[model samples]
Target: MQIEVLNSQASDINTIFQFYDMAVEHQKKVFNKHWQGFSKALIETEIAEHRQYKILVDDKVACIFAVTFNDKLIWGDRDKDSVYIHRIVTHPNYRGYSFVKEIIKWGKLFAPMNGIKFIRMDTWADNDKLLEYYTSCGFSFAGTVTMEQTEGLPKHYEGISLNLFEIEVNEVAASM
Candidate 1:
């Protein structure tokens, strides 16, 4: 399979939303909480800022995700030094392909090149499966935090406790 990672464009909004809807359906089946959906403006802004990304398998979108330079509401003081990953949605056809691992590999390279110190992501604190999966993918379980301030954030983040995962850029680079 030919795989390519590239920044998403505004025109891909419909496909992105399809993947997100599928993800939410999957989440509803497996978890107690599911994404409440993201605003069109929010996603459009990410696309315009080049913070949205997609992985394509032979030109078909297999996965999509967003990144932010800072996430003070969740990471607090440690936010600025990291690249925060959010809303990873993989197409059903690509479910078993280990795309999250690919994203991490991408982040390891993308971070330092952008002068970032760490690659960080978060999931529901109660998601034991994902916590284990992220650790297996080379992230350290940084801990859990209960979100106190969710203003301007997605609805899913409101009043939720999240499990933080991080991989230092230098650590990955040194090992490589």
Candidate 2:
């Protein structure tokens, strides 16, 4: 099977939303909290800016994710030198493929090329399984933070505590 990563396009919006909805349904079955859904405009902007990405296996979309250069509200001052990953959703057919590790491998190359110092991501603070999974995928737990200012963030982030995870760009190469 051939695997490729590419920026998402406007035509892929419906598929992306479908994946997100599926993810939320899965979350409802396994976790206490689930995504509240993202705004269409926000996604459109990410697409326009080339921040949205998808992994295709044999020309079919298998996973989707977004990346941002800034996440000051969740990360505070440390956000400046990092690329924040968000909204990772894998299609059910590809469930056991370990795509998060692929994203990390992609980030290792993407980060330094963009002059980023670290790759960062966040998940529900109480998600022990994800914490362990992310750690196993190469991230170090950077502690948790309760979001105080969620004005521009997704509704799910409001009044919630998130566990942060990060991998320094330099460390990625060393680990490999």
Candidate 3:
């Protein structure tokens, strides 16, 4: 398993395209706007801007995860201490491999090293499976967000609400 930050320019857009297609086929299963920000071009832009991160195993992409240090939620900030995990997806074919937990563990360690003390993530309010997954991975439900999506890709997803979860990297590490 090799986990490193792939530059957007270095990222393979084809992988994202394939993942986007699978995500769209089972949008409800994951509780995210599958076609929203992860389309080919958008992902490329995000990668180019260094707002996204990915994990690959055996030369096969296993997960897509992104973070923004500038956006501070309830816990920490770029200058303070938090990393907000935005998008995370495991290839559908790679499901049931327990790699999700590995990814979280990696974040707990990596975020702090990058000056982020807490790791925050959110999912659609209706995605119970994801909610459960996060909880089991040691994230605590913090709150809900009902942001207005009047512009950009968010605009394409109208009236969608997301549930937030967070876990302090230090705390998770100590517990481990």
lDDT, candidates in the order shown: 0.91, 0.93, 0.65
- The positional error of residue 15 in candidate 2, measured at the CA in angstroms, is 0.4
Instruction: Provide the TM-score for each candidate, comma-separated.
Output: 0.96, 0.96, 0.76
Candidate 2, residues 109-137: lDDT per residue as tens digits? 88877888898999999999999999999
Order the candidates by TM-score, highest first.
2, 1, 3
Task: Candidate 2: give the clashing pairs.
Answer: none
What value does the lDDT take at residue 40 in candidate 1?
Answer: 94
Runs of candidate 1 exceeding 4 Å displacement: 171-175
Worst 10 residues of 1 by lDDT: 167-176
Rank by lDDT, descending? 2, 1, 3
**lDDT per residue (tens digit) for residues 47-151 in model 3:** 787776666767678767667665433232222466677656678767776665765676776775676677777677777877888899788897776656434
**lDDT digits (tens) for residues 1-176 of candidate 1:** 88888999989999999989999999999999999999999999999999999999999999999999989999998887788999999998899888888898888878777888899999999999999999998999998999999998999999899999998889657346
Name the lDDT of candidate 1. 0.91
Number of the top-ranking candidate, with lDDT as the measure = 2
lDDT score, candidate 2: 0.93
Reference-based TM-score, model 1: 0.96
